[model samples]
Target: MRPNIVLFGDSITEQSFRYGGWGASLADAYSRKADVLVRGYGGYNTRWALFLLHHLFPLDSKKPPVATTIFFGANDAALLGRTSERQHVPIEEYKENLGKIVNHLKECSPTMLIVLITPPPIDEEGRMEYARATYGEKAMTSPERTNEVAGVYARGCVELARELDLRSINLWSKMQETDGWQKKYLSDGLHLTPEGNAVVFREVARVFCEAWLSAAEMPYDFPHHSEIDGKNPEKAFQQKCL
Candidate 1:
C-alpha cells in the first residue's frame, strides 16, 4: 500500500485543497509516492481538536500515515473579548492540548513522523478590512487577533516541538522575515494567500525530504507504462507484486 501523509489542523488545512493551496501542492508533490490525506476542521482550536484524535487516528487502524502535520493555533490565539473570543484558547491550555494530541498520535504509531507548524502572523488592518467588508455595520470595531499574540502561540508550538524532539516550522517568524508580509501572505488577515501557501508548501516539502520521503527517491505504486511491452503487456503486469 502507498504510504499516507496526513494534514491535520484548522481552516488553513480545510482550505488547502483550494486552488494554489499548500495541501494541494503537497498532493501534487507526493503524487505516485504517498497519499496526502486531509483531516482538517475549520475554526477548531486545540481544545476541540483533542477530542477527535481517537476517531481520526484510531489505534486499531490497519494503515497509519507515515507522517502528519499538526497546523493549528491561529484560532486559539484569538484575543479575549474580541469578536472571535468564542474560539479563544489560553496559551497554556493550547500548549497542553497540543501535547495531548502529539501523545495520542505517538501512541497510534511510534514511528509516525510528527511535524508541528506554528500559526502565521496576523494582519490586524487586513482583518479589520475583512470584517468590515463581510459584516458591514455589524462588524466589531477591534480586530479579533493580533500578531503579537500569535507569536506567543507560535513560540509555544516551537518550544513544544523542541521538547518533544519533533520537527517544526516557525511560520510566524519565517513570513515576517519578508517585508510587506501582511498583504502578501495573508488574504483576510488570517487566511493564507497563494504566496503564503507556497511558503508552507516549500517548508513542508523540505521537512518531508529530510525525513526520507523525497518524491524523487520514492518508488511509484505500479510499474511504469514504459516498462510494459505493448505486444506482451501481461508480462510487466505479472512481474509487479500488486
Candidate 2:
C-alpha cells in the first residue's frame, strides 16, 4: 500500500493556476509508493494554518496520513506595513503558532513524519515591478525597498524547526542554488510557476522516497529507470504535468 503525504503550505503550494502545484507533481512521481494531499491556501501564513488545522486535519482513527510536509513563509513574510488584521502576524506569534503546530502534530500522530519548509527568496526588483504593474506603485514600494526582510523570517522558521526537532527543507537556499530558479519557477516574483512547482516536487519526492527506503531498510532500485536515484532534472520536468 502507498503511504499518504499531506502538503500543508501557503500560496506557492496552492498555486495550481500557474500550472498546478507541486502536490500534483508529487502524486505522479510517487504513483507506485505514495499519494499526496494538497491543502495549500494562498495568502495564508503559519498562524492561519494552525488555526485551521483542526478543521483541515483530522488525525483520528480514520488512518491519518503518514506524513505532513509544511511549506509556509511567503505571505507571512509580506511586510506590507498595513494595519489590516491579516497583513501580518507578529514574529513572536509566528513562533508560537509553529510551536503549537509541531506539538499538536507530534501528539496526534506520533509516528507520522513532519517536515517544515523554509520560504523561497523573492526577487526584489522583479516582484516589486510586477506588483506595481498589477496593483500600482503604492503596493510595489514596500516590496522594492525591503531587502531580504522576509528572508529573515524564513531563516527564523529554520531555527524554530531545529529547536523543536522537526525535519525541515531549506527552500531559501535551494532556490538560490538553481540557475534562474526564480525566473523559471516563479509565476509572479512571489508565487511559483509550473516549472518552480516541479522543482519543489522533485526535492520533496527525493526526501520522501529516501525516508521510505530507509525505514524499510531496503535499497532503492529503479531498474527500469536508472536516471532517478533521488535526483534528476528530467524527473522535475516530468512532474510538472502531474
Candidate 2 TM-score versus the reference: 0.78
**lDDT tens string, model 2, 1-242?**
45677888787767643455677776665555566777888778877788787776665646667888888776776665542236476667777787787777776688888888878878777776787788774563445313276677777888998998777777777787888876876656766777777767767766766666232343222323545446565674464333
The clash number for model 2 is 1
Best by TM-score: 1
Residue 131 in model 1: shift from native, Å? 0.4
Q: Relative to the unseen true structure, what is the C-alpha lDDT of residue 76 in candidate 2, on a scale of 0 to 100?
A: 70
Predict model 2's lDDT versus the native.
0.69
Candidate 2 global Cα RMSD: 8.5
